[model samples]
Target: MVASGDVGVAFAMVCGAGAASSLGASCVFAVKVASPRVLAIALGFAAGVMIYVVFAEILSQNAIDSFQDAGYSGNAAYRLATACFFGGMLATAALEALAPAEVVAVLQSDPHTRDLLRMSIVTGLAIALHNVPEGLATFVGALEDSEVGASIAVAIAIHNIPEGICVAMPIYYATGSKWKAFFWGSLTGLAEPLGGLLGYLVLSKEEPLSFGIVFSLVAGMMVFVSFKELLPSAFRFDAIDRVVSTSVIVGMAVMAASLLLFTL
Candidate 1:
């Protein structure tokens, strides 16, 4: 007999395959060179995607649902979700603090040099692991509501642009080839659909416990990305850093206020 979650899994796989194909094709198109300042701006764009998802989608969704189910007062769920958001942030901060500095440093470097190829491969592995939950989120969203899924698709696509940039930047800097940079950067995006497939397979059933756990895990994963990946990269440039930081706060505040408005 087919497992309960098989359909979801199948959906995820299909989505993953499609996303991978699309990203692969997109990467082949090379763009002209830009300075470090431009690259930093690209990183900031990535920052916008990450921050927007966390506050606008992830935390906002969690707070509303958890607030009602937990039987918290109007203010309590808002407080709880806000706390959870920060908790997610703190958890990622801890992971960043504990993670091997050398590894991230290598990833932050240019991708072209032959010496760093092995390191780049390792970075790919790390990113692949990271991409799984994002895939799942997109898959589940798509499955649940087409509109929700569409929103998520846009968010994911935007989030991915910087990811491509991230992957390409190092390699392009090292090799100075737009083709090579775009190719590698675009390849990283394939992981999203793969992640979506995995998530759908695992979380298709309507078990509260499973839902809660997946939600928590998703929250954790986003936190890790936001702090470990996005924020640090944002800090690499002074102007971008300020803009990204302001964006983060604005993102969080907007979500928080929205939740407050809804609860009342």
Candidate 2:
């Protein structure tokens, strides 16, 4: 269990990690104005990051490792992980059902603008959902071992920068308001600390099985958002001919490098 004093330190680290998302959001100021192509590319880039991280880190590594920690191995772990992934997708679908297609009002007359806002919303929600379990894990880790927890938090913070951009860029481009985009991105980042608080109250580092399932579910959410929301909207953009595929690739590469660097 986490010590009382360590609780404060763990919470602080988790908050710092979450805040990195807002740091990523702040990057939006770099582009004061955006065009159709830029928006499409930004959406594609976000999707790419989520998809790559889901497959490479969340599912392939974290989920399986979690199952292994629970004493399951090989095919058993994979099967359960797959099941959890779909379950997460169903959860996202349920959340989607709560909102109509035109949930957010778009003042822009451009047809693609509606989809852009939708994509941003989907991305933000997915990122926020994913961050929760991560925060919990980090908090628990810090409770058990400060160095391990700190390392995880720092890696997550770096990972979150792109996630913040994933939420911020499309919103910035779609809404033409930096503050709105930053607000949404910052909002998603807050979920990390929320998770940390949840850990402090209830969860601990032990439930490998549960944590594994959660990791898979989060991966599923990313996959669902990427294919179901982000990519479709990106293709629908009028200036889609250029940048979509390239941006996606670049995002994937960056995510891969980020993961690799952490491993090394």
Candidate 3:
């Protein structure tokens, strides 16, 4: 059973994830400007980081952990992991389908203020949904290993920067209120802590959680967010192909190196 202290640590780490989003939002106010091309490249980079982590670390680790901890044969462990991964993807797909649509009509609205307000709210809600699994991942990692959790948090924080910009820029432009932008942007990340709390409560029973299943599910969620949300949104910015590609490559390389460094 996870000790009370460990639970506290896990919650703290999850809170840090929320703070990362706030930090990212703060950057928008600091710069007082937003560039679609820059945001696009950042989003591409975030996608690459998440994709690499999901495939290289999370999925592989899930299989290995299952084989070792659950006494499943290698094939069986892999199969189970794959199933859990797909299950997570299906869940995220459902969430995406149900994401708020009322604000979408604002895209075509003639009034710039109305358009920006609606767009900001929509972006915040979307990011909030994406952050749920991420929060769970961070909390779970921390519960298992503090170092691993910290690394994951750093990677997730990097990705959240662009998300913060997405929320902040439009709102600031629309309302010309830094406080409003910051509040909304920070609000988007609050879901992380809530997710973390829920995960802890569900997984902290006397029966230990299944690492394989949970990890695989988390990997799937990250993959869905990377491809379905981050990459597509990045491309929508009309960023130059080379910039996006280069950013993605650089992001993968950096995450790979970080993981390697942490292991050593």
After superposition on all C-alphas, the RMSD of every candidate to the true structure, in Å, is: 6.3, 6.8, 3.3
Per-candidate TM equals 0.60, 0.60, 0.82
Clashing pairs in 3: none
Give the TM-score comparing model 3 with the true structure, all chains together: 0.82
Worst 10 residues of 2 by lDDT: 100-109
Off by over 4 Å in 1: 1-31, 34-114, 144-152, 169-183, 239-242, 249-264
List where candidate 2 sits over 4 angstroms from the true fold: 1-33, 103-105, 108-205, 236-239, 262-264
Q: For candidate 3, give the lDDT of residue 16.
A: 82
Error of 1 at 241 (Å): 3.2
Per-residue accuracy of model 1 over 92-204 as CA lDDT, tens digit each: 45544543444346755645567676555555455544555566666655554444444455445544554454455565556667677666666666777677766665665
Best by TM-score: 3
Ranking by lDDT: 3, 2, 1
Q: Write the per-residue lDDT of candidate 2 for residues 1-264, one digit (tens) a residue.
A: 335788888898899889988887887888443445765776677667767767876678778888988899789999999999898788777766654443222323253555888777876776676677667655655654465466556656755765676678778888889899899988888988887887665535557786677677766766776786666656766343588888779878876776677667
Q: Could you tell me how far off, in angstroms, the CA of residue 67 lies in candidate 3 after the best superposition?
A: 5.6
lDDT value for candidate 1?
Answer: 0.54
Q: For model 3, where is the 10-residue window of minimal lDDT? A: 102-111
Ranking by TM-score: 3, 1, 2
Cα lDDT, model 2, residue 202: 56
